[model samples]
Target: MVWAFHTDEPEFCPQCGDSLETQSTEDGPRPHCANCRTTAYHNSGVMARTAVVDTDRVLLIERGAAGDVGAWATPGGYIDAGEPPREAAVRELEEETGLEAAPEALTPVNVGFLEFDGGESDVAVNYAVLRSETAGTVEAGSDAADARWWTRDALRADLPAEKNNLRAIGMETLLDLLDDRS
Candidate 1:
């Protein structure tokens, strides 16, 4: 299925100073530059989420800003251009939680559609990571306000009530994956 996450409205054409017209494409209706006949396609962003666990506890981060502020989520972010999802997972894990992990070490768990505010949607690629070696070094960094280990009970108790937010990043699915692995 087509993932609808972000939208862009181009009033004028970048190539020319003409107004953009609406045109339907395979993906969806997009803005078309009349002067240059260029269509501006807004594609969905891809995010990498990892369920990093240490023994019986899973690592969660409290978001500092943007969507889901103060809500707990797996350490993840948008995948950079030209970077693989696994590599992005590793990079985001380190950036958000200060946990060093290898790309090959992350195990693919699930793929789900996440819808955010502003009509943005993302294809969330979830993974299960169990690298106990770096568990002790995890500290909140980057976009995270705080990072901590939580038992399943604590996690279930503390997550936000918004089911859409939780499903967007496959938080519940990740928790289930952690349980299955354990």
Candidate 2:
């Protein structure tokens, strides 16, 4: 899990095209561009995931693209420019599962490092919602190759998998937390 995601900071100044040097600032050491007199700060991308749960079942999606292709995860995607996290959760839920949900219906349940295909630079702000809050039947769409609901036992059967799943080191703990919550 300890990967070099942020180690590839800017090697050269974006404006002056000069080699950048790590200079100490009040904030900490950052890539400093002397010619342009600016600091380059690479920030993590924001992602939103929604756990559409109803008592015993929660909707999950199979990754159709990068990261661990075919791994199951809560329906989610990157937040758009200027979009709120709650709205992004709803949008991602709809895009991946073909089910519509209101932003207000989502309740944030977790916020932590989520490894997308891009590594752990993208942080996940996750939400949980009841199935009754969603509209329409389930079907895979967008970046999801498969989408379906899973019970606790059904979810645990193939878990602790060696993939890009968060907490891949301890899926049993993840299952315990999820079970306790939903």
Candidate 3:
């Protein structure tokens, strides 16, 4: 997706708005706003995620509502204001999957950037990794329709074709980590 900066119009200076023009720079294209003499861009929202892997199977939550409904995704959600991402990740894991997790058990896995709807407002940062066995019984609530553990093959077969914000744990990465534990 194209990442463009923006700024408010002259009359609406100081308020957030689209940029008027794009100027090329060494870094890349940036929006230049004479009104505030600053650059404008939408900072990707930070989301906390946890990949709960048990044995050779990984847990996936089926979304029940908007923003990728019926798609299998990792346990996570947007970090609330003033809350740390790690804490948010753990909280979301438990709330959505009914799995209590310690903050340290969740290792940083990968960060993916995805743009949707023609970049109207497409930006997200996903922080995740394999979680410890401390995670409790699986529960389905909030925006999840169901929760289940799937093998790599099962996941590939079950995943929907159209998934916008779906975040699935990498099978190879999980397998490597599990092998290390063994």
Candidate 4:
């Protein structure tokens, strides 16, 4: 489930320091400002993507950013404002890994919350399966250093060099979700 933090207080908006009306009760506090037509807290929506693979191995890419740098992750990113989750998944997969993938369906996988320095983070929704009639070559692009497929055991065993703390979450959850399908 997604959580939202809304407030009308000037603190919420960097541009406008307008006074925000606060509603307080047993449910806690919520801020709404009519003039700004904004809430104090923003709701970060779900980011969905597919875990594409070749043979028994799954694909992963090294992140280019200092955050999670050198960390291995499936080629995926945030769902766009209007686009569907599946489309976003395919687009991200192609952009990051340079491999075209057609996602079959949403295979639910659990992703834990990640806390990063500088307060930047996202809620990730990952899928277990996607297919490609022709497996094209992979080249790293965008925010990726390298792209390659690794067997499940191999991927799990070499976790130290992979910077992302969520790698284990992604691998284990994808495996469990795929098991449900079979």
Candidate 5:
């Protein structure tokens, strides 16, 4: 998700210095501003992942940011407000892997959730596209440290059997995307 989960509750309202109190809303419990009467709703941030496939290999990028630094994952990121998730997926793909693609050229593979140890979470939409059409050589860009094509065998051997990699949806989605190419 694009939003970070806060482990602690807010003691003050964002709009005013008054203390924040819990109020019931249609969306459930939320923080209410005592002075401004403003209500805060918690929402999950949407994210997308692009699986660029070449033969039996899939493009993977090493994360450069903290939390998962140097760990490999599909090229993707949080969707910007007013932007479609597919477009965000393509944009992230191009930014991280230098592979240009369009929304229609990409196909949705799966949707999943990623939860962090600090209570942060994201709703991830996964996509895949054949590499024959996309242009430009693959290179690490944006916040990625590196980008490379990993064969299915290599992924299975390198990634842990447990759900611990940066792929977000785990290795099952990776295997499914690879199998779909057959």
Candidate 6:
């Protein structure tokens, strides 16, 4: 299925075993296999993140896998096919931090595109809600090494290091949005 392909997917056609060539399309260059006339379209991966807010603090997860290993970011991951973004955010939050958040309690905060070094890319949606709306103790699970609360002041004091040792996109943008909301 189309969902199985990444930005840097195989250069050979899945259907015909023929080498693929790059062809410019409206979206951009895509893999085209002339033998089978198959165009491997790479869809941007859908990801979701949630900030479990406790007054001035928010829950952060230390990634145990992928690009940001050991770096703290809000709880989140790629959304499963057919899952709604809000539900995905809540699911990821629970999966990473052991916190159960109501899907309806999550409010959309921000959305942005992320591209990785190996050509994997994602379009992430961020959500947030007060901690009172969620229930659970903080425990690292899934692909998280550590889970804990972090204050905006602490985060602002030193920008989080993500890919390229830059500020974490989720935290930076979500914090700015929180500032605007307050």
lDDT of each: 0.76, 0.75, 0.63, 0.62, 0.80, 0.76
Give residue 5's lDDT in candidate 3 (0 to 100): 32
Better of 3 and 5 by TM-score: 5
**Candidate number of the best lDDT:** 5
TM-score of 6: 0.80
* C-alpha RMSD (angstroms) for model 1: 3.6
> How well does each candidate superpose onto the true structure, as a TM-score?
0.83, 0.76, 0.67, 0.69, 0.84, 0.80
On TM-score, the leading prediction is: 5
lDDT of candidate 3 over 23-141, digit per residue (tens): 56777765655555555454555667777766667777888876678777777877777888788988888888888877767677766555555343322334444545465788887
Give per-residue CA lDDT, model 2, range 12-86, as digits (tens). Answer: 777778988999989899888788786777667678888877777777888898757878888888787779999
**Cα RMSD, model 3:** 5.4
RMSD of each: 3.6, 5.0, 5.4, 4.7, 3.2, 3.3
Q: Across residues 111-164, which tens digit of lDDT does each residue of candidate 4 receive? A: 545444444456777665544432567889888888777666776677565464
Instruction: Rank all candidate structures by their TM-score, best first, as comma-separated numbers.
Output: 5, 1, 6, 2, 4, 3
- Clashing residue pairs in candidate 3, if any? 5-40, 6-40
In the range 1-182, model 5's lDDT, one tens digit per residue, is: 12222345566766667887999887778777778887665556678998888878888988888578768888999998889999999899999999999799988888888777655667899888899868899999999999998888888787554423554656877777778775
> Is candidate 5 or 6 superior in TM-score?
5
Clash count of each predicted structure: 2, 0, 2, 7, 1, 0
Candidate 4, which segments miss by more than 4 Å at Cα? 1-27, 105-121, 130-135, 165-169, 175-182
The better-scoring model by TM-score among 1 and 4 is 1
Ranked by lDDT from best down, the candidates are: 5, 6, 1, 2, 3, 4
Error of 1 at 164 (Å): 9.1
Q: Write the per-residue lDDT of candidate 1 for residues 45-95, one digit (tens) a residue.
A: 888988787777888888887757787778888997779999999889999
